[model samples]
Target: MVDRCSLEKEYILSPELKFKSEIQQLNNLPKAKKEFPRLSEVPSQVLQQTIKQLHKGWEYFQKRGFGAPRFKKFGQFKSLLFPQFQENPVTNLHVKLPKIGAIPINLHRPIPTGFMVKQVRILRKADKWYASISLQCDVSVPDPMPHGHPIGVDVGLEKFLATSDGVLVKPPKFFKQLQSKLKLLQRRLSRKKKRSKNYEKQRLQVARLHHKIDNTRKDFHYKQAHALCDAGDMVFMEDLDYRITAKGMFGKQMLDAAFGQFRSIVKYVCWKRGKFFSTVDAKGTSQQCPECGEEVKKDLSVRIHDCPHCKYKTDRDVAAGQNIRNRGIKLISTVGQMGKETACADELPGAGVIQSRQVSQPRQGKTRKPKK
Candidate 1:
């Protein structure tokens, strides 16, 4: 009964306490019933109860190990989609387990009402206990804006995002903030003897540092992604190449930020609300000129793009964003023209994939806007 003011409780437990207690519970299983008078005297009721207890313990063991009940490397993934299994217990922080009793939720904000309460999941993030309670609610669609008001977003290290509106969101650079602490922890871990308790302790320290880094990076990505989603009538952003592209120093930092995750979440939520999202190509969008259609051979150091023939100069990222928008609109138009639903990735050589290096040959920027 989650009528806004339901059984909402949480608590932040120490890593040592949570780890030690769970490990002990999972490892300490009851002994088999020896000296049974008869199979009937053993009591089928008792046997069933004992089996249930063992089943719960087995689940915990499978998730964490028998020795130190810590999270698995890949973590536990549970979903209530079992075919024959009729019931599964809700993992709320406040929900009492058999014999172990309840673990309270330490909520930071007041729970809202008008939502049908669903099961709560208790998760251990770093050293804290968090209860994620999913509520059943039907949220409606928002008002629509007219066309010609769509947005395009270009992402990079210098600016986290460059929108079609010419707004540049700067990267938060979270790793830079905790550089000293990370360096200290890494150095200490290096100094510790291998396979020793001290080394294991240092490893935990490193893990905590990494967890902190992840949280900070995620926070920034959420703010930026959310803002972009809410602002746009139609969104167009680059589908970043997670592999080979994240090779350089800055690229590595961007990857750590989980750019793909951020974009995916934003896109998903928007799609649910009936909004459109388009992931444009990354190739020539950055290099091609948006104005007079010239290939400006600009280095990363050169922030301002100076088109030689057209004498057009603007911020490189801004120009890039314009190109992304233009390309996306053109691609969308072409798809609509064909009366078919297709993807830009499917855009092949003779298909929608734009080609030629005429901008560099001679007429570079001198030529007026080429036929779109």
Candidate 2:
């Protein structure tokens, strides 16, 4: 359906008109069944949902600058979504589908009584089948705002995370730990004949290993994010461009660090817990001296920030965190003043603040002429 719509839209010229035409054509069951016999077996609602999804993708591409929707291969289309689930008979450990009957579901946790099941999506991962159920419920009580210390965090490959309070977090390199085992599995799989039973089994083994690594990394990130949210009322961090950074010399390391995932988790967790979360410009956060605001140019090898001007010495990551904190405070203060709500660094009880120092010129080195 997506392919047909995409092809028709090319000749139609107007997307709006093409979408309308497609909807009308899809709604006509008699014509649709004659054209595509498979449409007769599938529920009308599911087919319409697929068309709706295709239209949404095109709309997103046009309005939000998203990538154009592409054709999905047999295995690539791994999920079937039912926007509305029938609620005639509800079972504790089973879900009824249109074509497929009630499938057994492993209920790890019980759902709330008042919540209504809105949608059901069945996904296939490797050989395992899983159901993602969306639920909606009314909220009578609002969650209280998070109240705690305000801290700035700096994340990097070396330390994983460094905070303004002089705390450092080391990331568990899940992929790195299993790299050798994964390589062995992959090599063994490559040696097996394609499409053979042994090849399929080896492929599943490799996929399972990859899934385990992904889950482990995600678990680590979630725990760290939750801890930070629970500990801090206002969390500040640098707004980094992961795409640009991932193309550098240490691209592999950058990707392995999963900085983007960490930031996303932190942001969402903060939102959920009613904590203040903001990002500051990352430009000079690391290079600038937190004490005097002097640019202390140094290479990546410089782990310690030794400011020549103010004679300030500290761990590079900690200094960066302090700088980020200061910037965040300034930003909040400015915004608050503009809105006539005087917000100060002192308002955040346990927030760390950097003392300003007078900038001093560094001693210049003598220039030497090249020996000819």
RMSD of each: 14.5, 9.3
Tens digit of lDDT per residue, candidate 2, span 102-159?
A: 8788877877788888888778776678888788888764543323456688999888
Best by TM-score: 2
Per-candidate TM-score against the hidden true structure:
0.58, 0.79
The local distance difference test score of model 1 is: 0.59
**lDDT of each residue in 84-193, candidate 1, tens digit only:** 11133333334433323455655555546565544444456655556565655688756432232345778777777777556776666678778889999999999999
After the best TM-score superposition of candidate 1, give how far the Cα of residue 9 lies from its true spot, in angstroms: 44
Highest lDDT against the true fold, candidate: 2
What TM-score would you give candidate 1 relative to the actual structure? Answer: 0.58
Residue 39 of model 2, lDDT score: 78
- TM-score (C-alpha, index-matched) for candidate 2: 0.79
